[model samples]
Each structure stands twice: as C-alpha cells, then as structure tokens.
Target: MADRVGEQLGNYRLVRLLGQGGFAEVYLGEHIYLGTAAAIKVLYAKLASDDFEHFRKEARTIARLVHPHIVRVLDYGIEGTTPFLVVDYAPNGTLRTRHPKGVPVPLPTVVSYVTQIAEALQYAHDQKVIHRDVKPENVLFGRRNEVLLSDFGIALVAMTSNYRSTQGMQDMAGTIAYMAPEQIQAQAETASDQYSLAVVTYELLSGARPFQGAFTEVAVKHTLVPPPSLREKLPMISADVEAVEMKALAKDPKQRFVDVQTFAAALEEASRNASSRTTFLGDIPVSQEQGASFSPETIVLSQQEAQEVSPTALFTTPDVAQQPSTDELLADKPATAAMITPAFEQKEAVEAVEAVNTPVLKEKETTALTSQPPHKGISRRAVLVGLAGAAIVGVVGGGIALLTHPLGSQTAIQPGNVPPGTNGGTLYTFRGHSGWVWSVGWSPNGARIASGSGDATAQVWDATSGGHLIVYSGHSDSVYGVAWSPDRKRVASGGFDKTVQIWDATFGDHYYTYHGHSGWVWAVAWSPGGKHVASAGQDTTVQVWDSANGRHANTYRGHSGFVHAVAWSPDGKRIASASSDGTVQVWDAVTGVRLYTYEPYFTDIWSVAWSPDGKRIASASDDKTVQVWDALDGSHLYIYTGHTDFVYAVAWSPDGKYIASAGDDKTVQVWSAIDGTLVYTYRGHTAGVRSVGWAPDGKRITSGSWDETVQVWKME
Candidate 1:
C-alpha cells in the first residue's frame, strides 16, 4: 500500500496510483513480460489478513462472467498476505469522471451507458452473481468508449465483512446516494442493483440525484419518501421516461421491474414515448465537396402556415402569367375539345370567360359564381359553359383558383376525383381491405403493391391500376409488415401471429412460414441477394433466416425493447433494425455481430430505411420527425419535420433523391433526401397513415392508412 509506482506487485509493474477506496487502492499497472496494461486493485494489508479468503472467492466468481459489457478479471493472488486483483484497464476513465456532478450528459449518452450497465448486470444475475453496489464510479469506459461494469461481486464481500467487524452497526460498502432502500436495510436483492442503476440514470439525465442531503438523511428518504419528479429539474424530460425512473426507485422492490433488463427496456421504451423537440444545428456538410451542405433546421409550420398554399407549396402548381391556348387544351383529348366548343358558344358565357381571361380574375367572379340572380332565365348549356370555363381558368392560372375559391372550401382534389397522371394528386386508391391497412411495400419491379391489413391478410395488387391480384390469408392476427424480394418473385409478411410467412409473389401461394419469434412480428425485410429474410418483433430480437426453407440462420438479441422495423443494406452485408428501445442498430448480416448503433435522442423508432446506395439511413419515430444519418459513423445528416404527428414509416426513394414518410398525421410527406426540403405532402387519407414506400422507379409513393385503404400517388 506504500507508494507502489515504479515497483512490481508480483509480475505486474505498478505504474501509478489510480485512486483509493475504503477497502482497496487501485493502480495502473503493466505486465512485465506481455507489456499489456491492467488495473490493479490492492487490498489494505490489515483488512486483507482478516478477509483474504472471502475476497479471493468473490474475485474468482466475478472472473468467470465473460461478457462484452462486464470488466474482465485477469490475475488475482496474494503477495505475502496482501491480496491484489488485476482487471481490464479502462483507459478513458470511469463514468463518474467523464460525467461529473452538475454536468448535463446528453440523453443519448445516458441511455447508451445505462443500457450497457443493465445488460452486464443481467448477465451477472443470470450467473447468480449480484453486483450489490451499482454506481457511476464503478462504470468505466474503455478506449472506444465502450461501457464496462467494474468491481462486480466485490461489494457484497466487503459489506459482509464490515457488518461482522462493526458488530451490526452501519455498513459503508456502496455509495450512499445510489444505495437502494433494501440495501440500506441490510436485505439487498437483485432489485437493489436495479434501484441503484435508476439513481445513476436519474443523475446522468437531470444532472442531480433524485435525493440529495446528509448521508443519513439520504438513506432515510430512499426508505420512506418518494423521489422528486424529474420534470421539476428537466422540463424537457418526457413524462414516460420520468415514470420509468420513478418506478425503478420504488421503495417496494415488488413494484419495480422483475429484472434489470426489464427495467432498462422500460427506460428505453419511455424515452421513445417522450415528447421530443429538436433545434436547428445549422447546416451540416454531407458530401466532401466544399459548400455542399444541407441545413438541419426543423421546418415546423404553424397550423395556418401549414394549411396555406404558399409559393413553396410542394404539390401546388406554380402561378402562371398566361392562359392556356385553345390548341393546348385540345391537344390532350378530342372528346374534351368537343365539350369545350359547346361550353363556350353562348355570348353570355363568352363574356364571362373573357372576364376571367384578364390579368387577374376579379373577386366579383367568386360572388357571381356563388350568387346567381333567381329571376334570370339561363339555359343549362350556358351554365355548363360557364362552369367549364371556370374550371379551365383555374387549371390554367393557379392564382385564378386561389382568388375565386371560397375560404375553407375543399379546393384540393377529393379522394374519388383523383385524375390519372395528376402531378400532385392521388393516382389510385385500393379499397378492398376489410380492416386497417397497417403496412405496404412495392414490388422490386414496381409492378405490384403488397399491403398488410388488420384483417389478418396481405393483399397483392397492380400498382398502377389498383386492381386486386391475390390475397394471402393465413395469419390469425393483424399483419404488420410486408416485403418483396429483390427478384420480385417472393413476398414476406410478418404479423401479430408471431410468424413470418413467405409466399410466391406471382401467385400468392405459401412457400414457407417462420415460427421462431415469441411475440408479435412487427417487421420483415428481404436481403439484397433474395436468399435471406430478416424479421423482428415484440420478442426483442431480430431473426435472420433462409427464405426458401425458413431455417433460422441467426438471431440478433441486442435490443431490449420491441423491434419494430428491419432493413437490409443494399449490398446484403448488414441489417438495420429500428426498435421501441429508441435505437437503430446496424449489424453484420452473416456474422450477426452488431456493427453500429444510432441513438438520436428520440423515443420509439417505428421504422428504418436504408438509402439506395447504403451510405445513409432514414428512421421514422414517435418523435414526429424523420431523421437521416450516416450509416457508417451514425452522424446525423438531416432531420425532416414535415409530419405533424408520430411518424410511423419512412422509405427512401430508389433513385436516392427523396424520402417518403407516413404517420399519425393523416398525411404522407415526400422530402428531398439531400437537403431535407419538403417536396410534397399527400393529404388524401382521412385517418392516420401507417406505412409508406416508394415505387422501384421512384416516380410514385404508396401509403396504407387506418382508413382501410392503400393509396398510391405520383411523387412529383
């Protein structure tokens, strides 16, 4: 315990003293022969003589737990009755050092660190080992900032010895502020670790502990008083997330989650359910070219501003200075030309038309259209001619319609009135589904549309004609997701039935059914090579399987919440999954090793779509926005906020120019993928739009709605 720097403890050359705790002193050490660094914890000589056997037993137990998130123990022995343990050296530092008191850690960082701690604790719990002391000080970070739960199982050993030595007085093993009520009462259980973790989570998020006072007072409050609401300190903290923290701090262990993993999953789910507000972080550079940047501003439109047809309206035609020529009107169709001649023959109608042809259509035309003289005798032909001229003038000059149309009137095309090839209107509405249409996907060739419905069936139809082709109907519950293979020959559908069914896309014949998930199957994706299908669900796992025979190939179990959506990288090397756990994880498809995770400080991510080139990812979430981020490094590229409600689905255009999103806002918004500019808003759906997808050619987008219809519209 003397100055051990420049000295050797057994074979480890002690470099410098790291820190000292009550029972042990930690030092940075290096292996003499291997030249590898380690953290050496040396027991106090007096205490080691009395509790050497107990410390060795606990250290051996902790060393047996081999997990990525848990600190690995290397060597442990006694050097002349002075016990010492060697552990993996975390170069970055402990969580307490990185995020000190009164420092507000970013929400994403808090969630990520907490999740790693929870996973490590859960693994230890499964091995019948309790951490007994869970605090930020015991959580270390490695060179890559990877979280490592340290000093596992040692706290119980120290506290037990202290209790006996002090004759049942006060035990001072764990940090007072983070000790659970049960721990203070000397009856700590697995739930005690969960409670302590919650305290650390609260401190990280709000920059203050839930209860702060004298050591005795803090212990009393943990046993009796309820923690203060997190919102009082951090108003932006979502109510749901705060609730999770409070639940974990419950005095009665029975009221809390049954396991540490469950508690962590609840916190993750609460983060997604929390209301999110994002600020514009100025323009972000995407490409390497200088000045090639896209503004990350969230374009939030007021109710009135959103409803108004401004100059930047995505779907509205630009105002024209000249009227449509007679030849231009007649060139499209001969039948419309014949009707135009009769519609303009009457002199009164001709005069009315001439009035509309002026520089601007006068407000008097609106008054004339709404109020006709009751005594004036008018032929039906003249009335028809006047109406036709008004319609033609409205189409020819956009200003004429805005000026003449009544306020709050339905000027936009109605559902059934959608015209073919219309620039910004619904092209087709497939309406045979008996229940809510929850998801939709376009065929790889863009020739067919497959829709999953709450009626427990998936319907295939002609993409252009809206003709129902075939129905795949074996699921006993709602179908939530559907996908088409790259070759366009097979389709995969997942549902509340907890199964993923693969079928022949051409004939609707069942091919194979995957039955591994233990919860509702919420999403399915086909690999680029069309050989594998990935499905994820409420089971908190992503299952990759061979599409032909439904043989399970791999299972990715990183997410702690329901996995809502999954997508394969364009090259088929990686898979991306969005979860209710507020994370988007990308993993190696073949190895099943997680590659990267994107935590965007939002709650439940409902859908994730990889960009066409596989360089970026677009995610839709309950945060009422669609976010685009770099696929490799997880850097945020753009945030599109056109949707006014929770965004449920996001689809990147095949050509990589646009991103289409549908959500509870009853609208589907298309935005430029490069600049996050709102390109168009399709608002024909009368209910929340659940799913959206782009055509293979990127010319159109299709959406399924709770209104029980699938609507396909031109993107432009």
Candidate 2:
C-alpha cells in the first residue's frame, strides 16, 4: 500500500511509518480522542484478504495475552483493503536496533532480556499461543528500556494464512535462523518457542547465530546441527550457563527444557553462581555489523534434493549430531542476511525516530559533535507521538559512521549566543578519552569542563576551544563520576576503583582519597561552599567527607539499593540521592537523618537534580520520565515525557527555567522546569547519553556519552 501518513483507521490516526517488513508495516499511531500513542501494524491487503477473520481472532488472543513484558493489541480493523492491528507503542525501538548484529551486549543486560522475555513466553504458552517468530527485531524496548515481546501471534496468523492440515515440513513459517527444527517441519509447539528463545540467547551471548548461510542451509542446520559450545566462543560465560543454553537449543522438542521459564531460571542460577574468576564485561567492544537477518520468504528445495533428504539425511553434515564444524559457522561474518525482504528492516542502531523532532546537537566548529539539520525523509507526522528521539542517521547497511575526531578549527574563543530551537545546537566536542565518557561537569568559573571516562582517567579541558588541559589517571578502572570543586582549585573523581580521589585541578596531582564507601563509586558531587564532597555508588549509601582532608563527615544509609545519583540542595542543608530501590531519599546534609523518601516512581532512579531555588527536585528514572516534585514534602509536580527510553541524567539549567535530561535514547533534551514541555532536543551523541551538566553561565550544557565523547552545546 502507498503511504498513509495521516489516515484514520478505527480509533487511531496513522501518524508515520515506524518500521516495515516483508509481510507487514508498523506505523506510529495516535488515539483519535485520547491522544494515546500506539504501534499500528498494517498487513498487506493480499495477505490479509485470505484470513481476515482468523487474523481478527488471533488479534483477540494477542490482546488478551496481556503481561508486563508482552505487547497488548488494543484494536484491529480493515482499512480499505489493508488489515491493521493497533498494539502498545514502544517508542524505544527494537533490540536489533540496540544490540546491532556483531556486537556483544553487556551480559547483565542480556540476562535481563532473557528473564523478562521468558516470563512473557511462559505466559503466552500457558494460554496456548506459540509465537512463531522470536528474534531481536520482534523484541522491543518499552518506555524505560524494559524488554517487551512483540509480534506475538503475528507470524502464526500472517504466515499460516495458507495453513493446510496436509502441509507439514513443506509449509513451515518463521525467520529461519531462529526457527526451531519442529517449526521448520510445521510442528510448532510451546517447545518450539523455547528453542527459538535459546537461539536468541546464544546469539546474544556469542554475538553470532549458530546457523548461517542461505535459508535452506540454515533450516537444515536447525534439524541436524548441534550448536557450538557457548563457552568456547565466550569464555566469560560459565559452564553451567552454557549447559542451560545447550539444553534449550536441543534439536528435538522433547530434548529441550521443560519450559522457557525453567531454561531462564537455570541461566540465571548459572550467572549468579559465576566463579570468582569469571568476568562478564570482557572487552566492552563497540557495535559492529550483524549477520544475515531471517527473512519471511519461503525456502525452496529442488525436487531430487527434497526426496533424498529424508529424516535419515538430516545428520550427514558432520556426526549424526553435529551439523557442521564450529570453525566454519563461527567465523565472524554476514551470513547472506535477507536484507531485501526482511520481516522488518532493521536500522543500524535504535536511533529513535524523533517524535517531536528527536533533534540533534550541532558541533560548534571546534567540538567533537556538531549539530546538523534533520534528515530530509523523516516523517514530520512522527512528532504527533511523544515516545521517540529525533533521528540522527537513517538506515545504513555499513553501520553508523560516528564523528570522534576534532572537526573544526582548534582556536579557543568563548562562544557567546547561538539561537536555540527544539533541536539544540552543538558548540564543541572534547576528545581525548580512549573509552566511553561516563560523567561530565562544568567548572564553577565556567572556563573549563571536567570529564570522567572508562579509560580509567578523568580530564579537564577548555569548554569552548575543545583544547586538552588536565589529565588525572589515578583511577585503576573506568571512572564513572567526576566533579569540580566549588573553589575550582580541585576535582574529585571515582569509579571502579571504589575510592573517591581528590586531585589538584591544574597539575593533576592527587590530593587525599576518601575510602568511606566500600563499593565502586558511581557519582561524586561538591558542596556549594567548597568544604564538603558527596560520593555514592554500589555501596547503597551516600558518604560525605571534608574536601580539605579525607575525614568522613556523615554517611547516609537510607537507600536499600545502589545509589546512582546525588545532588545537594541549593541551601546546602539537604541532599537528595536517587537509588535502584525506586525512591529518591532526602536527608539532612550534616546529620544524615532522613527528611523525606520521595516515591514518585517504582523503578530505578538513574539521575536526580535540585532546582536552583532548592524548592523542587527533578529525577530521571527507568520509567522513561523526568519527574519534578516538591523537595520538602515530596509532593508530585510534573514529568517530562519526551524521551522513549531510560532517562539517565537530569540537570537543572543554571537560571532554573529549563531542565536538561539525557538517557539510553541517545538524545539530550531540554524542557521546561515548570510544566515539563520539551524546549529542545540535542541529538549530538551516537550512543546513550550518560551525564549532563549546565554551565555556570547558563549558556552552555555539557553531556557525556557511550560513544566515548563529551559534547558541549549552546543553550541559546
């Protein structure tokens, strides 16, 4: 069908196309009356023509299989010749966009995906629904990076439209790479889903699918192949975990685990029982090209080949058990992926399609990132919804081309004013760190900026000139936090080393180290008067110490989980600490007594900030929002809902009128401090934005990102 950018179908108005596949197209839709957003998947007319009623019944099953981890179908209808199902909109994009193809996701993140998706699959299985297709593109991220299982029953309805009782192996349906052997033989049961999930887990852990090559070869391997050992490819994975994965990937449905949940539980147990020597994060490598995707097109076998390949021929590749040698299959490569008729054309990364111009941050000549105009072909109607970030780059087969080197002249001139729009402009990008930049801060005098990186060091650089200045390499691991002393004479940085170290601002010499927290320090902050410093992290406590000496002042033990972010009230009398316990606790700065436990959200708090006047607190959360509430009574104020993924960092603009929030969505958004209306979105970074800080002069904002760069952008 042609583009229906503004067409109304049932209760939803099709705003813009989100993603398209060989069998269906997903559109960003808005509820006509309530303005609630949804993903409207429109199946081609020809496919829908034959099974319109079956499709509706399947839609009912999908809508009622409601679980926290499963996408709920809200409505279904036939618009003219096309049939569409409106489901819960996940603005954060799909896992294929986030993990890419050739990259290994952090082990912890992959396990989380398994846990949630397993529960969803178990729930669907209990209801007698076997999701024929289970892959990264079918798994989407909800508002706060929560894994959501989508395409539930979509394959069963669409691909099986021509289902005939006589059709068995000749009429199989699914993305071939993840398809179970039973599914390839048209014997899809709950166990088939289990096998598919195991394939996904293996792919996630080892960064490559076990089966590769043409659709026919991949399908045959599902029948005969004994998957390669997961530990052999990723030694970081323990043997127990490998066993669990192998059990799930068994070629015979009965040979697999009893259920997907059991498989997930076993994997979790193995991960928890990891040996003392096991390391989850091995290299922290960047994203690379993914292998050939599973296209929905049919697999054809020649007449003689089909007759010759009976059940007996399935094991002729290697041993009766092994399909092919591991060396040949695991050779990092693109396995003739179905780029042409992809079920859904996967993007390079989940570069969120801007729902309100998920705008970019321009590099102002000398910076690491420069701002650019929005891409020409992006849907303007996409802005009708509020769950996506502005698009930085379009779909590219070669992968994202990032700009990390110096782009403009290296002359230092203090930038004055640059006109600001919904998409903020980049002023400069500071480069030098050899790893992901985790934290960034503006100096008290506004002349310099401080950045902490996974390179195991913290550096101070000129804010405008992008000139390198101070480099503090005292940390033994990745530095997660960095802060400037109020007096501008010193800096405090901390991270995997578990010690908060203070150093001279000019000479990068160590001052005194604070060992109050017995954990990796995640955040560090300096008091306004320049007398005290606050550091919090995995210890689940916020520790305060004197900047002059390493003497401890007060230790706040109010949080029940890891403390991610900490901010001092403007009056300096109170401190707010956000934690994984789903609460932001405020306490008396000196006494360490609790003032209030703000529970506006029931998820992880990634960042927190205090307004300039100290009366309100703004927190970034896994709930995909920046919530502002009363600082004293903890009364709810308002939430900024522009972001589509986990909101990582939030900062109050110096003048206090605006707030800047950044997160996994890879955009730095500036919005109203009072009502939470988005003012500008800075899509400067190519990776998740981890840290944001406003310049003392209020004309600039600095943000750190996983792309391993710190970007400074103009506020004006």
Candidate 3:
C-alpha cells in the first residue's frame, strides 16, 4: 500500500500515515475546507473491488449514527475504487496504551470507562448497526479517562432487508478474545456485539481475559466451561457490580442485557459503590517483584529499548514534559510529610479569623419538611415495603395450597408464620397429585395461581383464599407450561397435546385452541402488548399465534433439538427461545425469522426470559447455572451460580429489578437483576422445584415443586 498523505481527495488533505494493515491503512488527515483534523481509513487497493461494496455499506451505516462516545464518522467516498472512511481523531490514544500495566484499577474507574463504551454501543445498536469488534485496542481514552469506541469496520447492518452476506466467516468477524460463543460458532448477529462488550468489561475490571489460550482451547472454554465470577477474584467488589458483570456475560443472549444503555446504567450504579482491591485476576498471585521485571519480549514499550532513544526527545509533550512545579514536586516529599500536624492545627485558627471578619445574617428564612404518612399496604414499622399485595390460597382440585402473608410488621404475624429469611415456615403436603407438576405461575395481580401437571390437567386457584378456582381438564397428555396473559383476562397452557389451550381467566371455559407444533409444547409466553403469544416445543420450533384467534402467525425453525422455553421481549418486536441443542435463538416476533443464535453452553438450555425494558435476556441451563447476554449483539454478560442441580426455570420481575430461578436442587433463589447478587434463597421442598414466578407488583414469589405442593413466599 502507498501513503496518500499530502494528497487531496474530496476536500481533505492527508497529513501522515498512522497505521497500516493487510486490509486497510489509517492516516492523519485535515479537511482543506473545514480545516479540522480527522482520521481517514482507506481499504487496500489490491482487495478494493471485492470488499469495497461492503465497506461503503458499513460507512453509510455508521455515518448516520451520532454518539458522544463513538468515533464520529464524518464522510465516505471512493477514489478510483479505493474506498475510504473519515472518522473523528481523538487526541488521546487507544485505551490499550493508557491502561496501567500489571495493575487493576479501582472498580469505580473501570465501571466509568465501560459504562461510557456501553452507552455508545447502545446508540449504535438502536440505529440498527452492530459494532462487530469490541476490544480495548478499539477503544480510545479522552480527558479524565473518558472512553470512546472506535473502528466499526466490521459492523453489520441489522435492518430487515437483503443486505447481509451469506458468507459464514463474515458472521464470525470480531477479535477472538472478545467474541461471544455464538460468533465463534458462526452464528453472529447484533447480540454478538453485546457479548463482546461484556468480555471487554470483564477484562477492564479484572485485568485479565476470562478465557484465553490456544484458539481451540478458548473456543471450547467459552462453549463448555463456566466463567469465573468477578467477585471471586476481587473479594471487596460490591455485590451489585458483580451482578451487573455476571448478567452481561449470560450464555444465552436472551438472558443478557437487551441493549447497551441498560447494561451501562447498571454498571454505573455498581461502580459508584464499588470497593474491590484485588491486584491480579483469576488465581494469579501478585508479588512485589512482579512490577520490577519488565521483559522486552512480553511487554510492548516501543521507544525505550531502541538504542538511539533520547530522554529530551521522549519528553517532547508541552503539558507533561516540563519540570514539575515547586509545590507539586515538594508536596509529598518526606520533609513535608512531617509538617502535616502544624498545618492541621493552623486550619481552625485560619477559619476563626475568617469568621470574625464575616458578617452574620440579620434575618433568616426557615422551612421544615414534614414526614408523609406510610403507604396504604405498608406498615409504619416495616423495614421493607413491597411494590404490591401478597395473597395465599389452597386449591382442592389441583392438590395445591397457597399461603398469603401481608406486607407489614412481623409483630402481628401468626405463630407458625416466619418472617422473611427465616426457616420457620410450615411444610404442608398435598397428597392428591400422583405425577409431576411441570409448570406453575402466579397471576399478574397475585390473586390466582395456575398449574400444569403431568397428570394432563391444568388447574387454577384463588391464591389469597387457598381455595380451588377451577380445573380445565381437556389436554390428552401431560400439560407442560402455563402462563397468564398480561391483562389477567385469559390463561394459556401447552402440553403433549401439541396444542395450546386459552381459557377465560375467571372461569374454566375454553375460548381458543392453537394447534401447530409437531412435538410436545414445552413453554409459552405473552407479548408485552398482549396481542400475540409465543410457544416453543420438542419440535425444535417456535410459533407465534394471534391472541384473539387461534390463527398461526409464523413458525420459526432453527434449533437442532427440542425447544424448551420461549419468551417475548418487552417491546413485542423480538422473541427468544432456548433449546436442548445448547443454543438460544433470537427471532423477529412477527416474522419468525431467526435473527441471532447464541451457542455458549455445552449442554441444554432449559429456560429463557426477557427483561421488562426488552433490552436483555436471561437463560438457565443444564450446565447448572444461568448466563446473561447482550440482546443486541449476543455478547456474554456474566454467569450466575448457586444451584447445585440443573436450573429448570428463570423469571424476571415486572420492574426488571429481580430474577427468580428454580431448579432440581429443590430450592428457589432470588437475585438482584441489576447486578446478579443473591438476595434470598428458599429451601423447603423435599424434591425438585421446577418452576418459579413473581407477582406483578414484585413483592412476592411462588414456586411449584415435585414434592406435590406450591409454596408462596414474600420477597422483602
């Protein structure tokens, strides 16, 4: 490649070559007309014709996206088939250069940096562009260590058009260290960018990549092994920060952050209260001698080892090169360290002198703030107030019992009732059911409870009163899943009948039956708008159906094995389904076209659910854990643990504040969704607890177990 510096092209004058690589060369350039400095990247002339079209498409896509943390794309053109892109020239170098080597930064700084990058990536995702590559090398640092994401050269347009390539490798384009499992498996999409961002953030805070080795080793680790938790290395790191990082690295894209903004917000909050102090990542030990040995082979310090290097030439920068001021150079010296006591004693005397010279106010305006009364359902003595009501019910026909606990003071509570976090609750046994209860859910208003049992029956109950509502017995085989519509007006159930039964919420009257899947329908969910329903099954398919009628809207087929769970994004535009083949697929809810496939775990994916904002997805798996991914680029966010057995189900609260997971371990764990912190763990069932659900108000949670009883617990 030849340098184009000093050559005029499209009102810009190239100044000097910045870097060169096989595919492209970047140059420091200036706009002859605007007189502004810019960075211009031009494709290699040899491969111009073949990759030019793709380059132009990507440039156009980026030029339309405007974000403060992203490198601004100002212009693009082709000069005799040599395609080029003009982007902003950041004064600070890449983040890779600015980072302190062999040292982990404070948690707050890491969060601040990653948050800024995530915000920029979120902006690009909202514009339907995926920054295929996200690594420290591509991020630039600005004043006060502000971060900026650069180089969208491999970005893919996410529009619903025929603009994408059929080439398999293009789908896998990204830095290897940061690529999500889906991208490594050649199924990359917008969500892949999210996974990459999580990897970058993990490295940013921990000072080491989660998985790095030979190409095959790293790939296998990402697919089969669990990532070490951030808290495990930095014991002092806050629980919230750990949760956010873990959520971002979820193996299932649907289970991860839906977009960059939500992930960034969570990271920001976590960083503000962070307190980690570990010096090294993983199990590595940090010794005093570690900083002394800077080998030339391992470290990349360019100017130092060169024999011709000069000290005066090295200190050429005007701002930092000058001799330090007398105050700065002498402030922290040993001599000044002994003068601290005198200065401290003089401080109060100086303040007293100033106070004597200042005048006192003659008149003052005073106002007092009055304490407001406690909320309607909240007790004045309660330490925690829930967002809504808690009710319990016992059902006869379904062999179920609901227990209601009001959200108030514990002083008036029943003798047998236990306060939140106590192991003093009763273990009531329902002996009527002879088979497993495959699925169970609480109504939005927390008034009714529903269950689908392997006995081929779907039953409803009054949650607060502990009375049986009705049993809708029509499916020929075992009923597997049940869900209440968002409006609480209808109920939908799927079973081995290969059909979905929709019933009137108040009664057991069957209203509509949707017949489509070739195998057992394992799970179903209502869209946020309540206009459509999504179902997945052993048929390796996902079907969207009309909520008003039994009409099939679309059928999605991509999973290689049984499809176990399905969930709708909060916006109703996307749906995610997890399969036994160890992949989670994101699809267009209306068209059923597979948009992205996440292949992280080596075993089966058991459940999938979307956050309330529709920006993230969470998936539980046979791997005995849950992973959160970026919903936009399929990036891994974080991995969650605590279950000793395979995770069976996962659900997000209506506020997207909490996550509840139940598994074969016979326990249910509630986590802080914002940061993946374990808040409460309920262990009562003698057998496996297969399903869990939260009330609409997010105050309480319920679980169905194979021990033949449904246990309801209040979440404080």
Q: In model 3, what is the error at residue 98, expressed in angstroms?
A: 84
**Candidate 2: misplaced stretches above 4 Å?**
1-424
Residues 239-340 of candidate 1 have per-residue lDDT tens digits of 567656766776567656778898788777666555265221212222211111111110112224323422212221112223343334324432221222
What's the ranking of the predictions by TM-score, best on top? 2, 1, 3
Look at candidate 1 and give me any clashing residue pairs: 272-603, 272-604
Model 2, position 310, has a per-residue lDDT of 25
TM-score-best of 2 and 3: 2
lDDT of 3 by residue, 636-681 (tens): 8888886765688898988888888887656788888877888877
Q: What would the per-residue lDDT of candidate 2 be over residues 61-129, giving only the tens digit for each residue?
A: 778988999988888877665667888889898888887676676667777899999999999899988
How many steric clashes between backbone atoms does each model show?
2, 21, 44
Better of 1 and 2 by TM-score: 2
Local distance difference test, per candidate? 0.68, 0.68, 0.62
Candidate 1: stretches off by over 4 Å: 1-424
Model 2 C-alpha lDDT versus the unseen true structure: 0.68
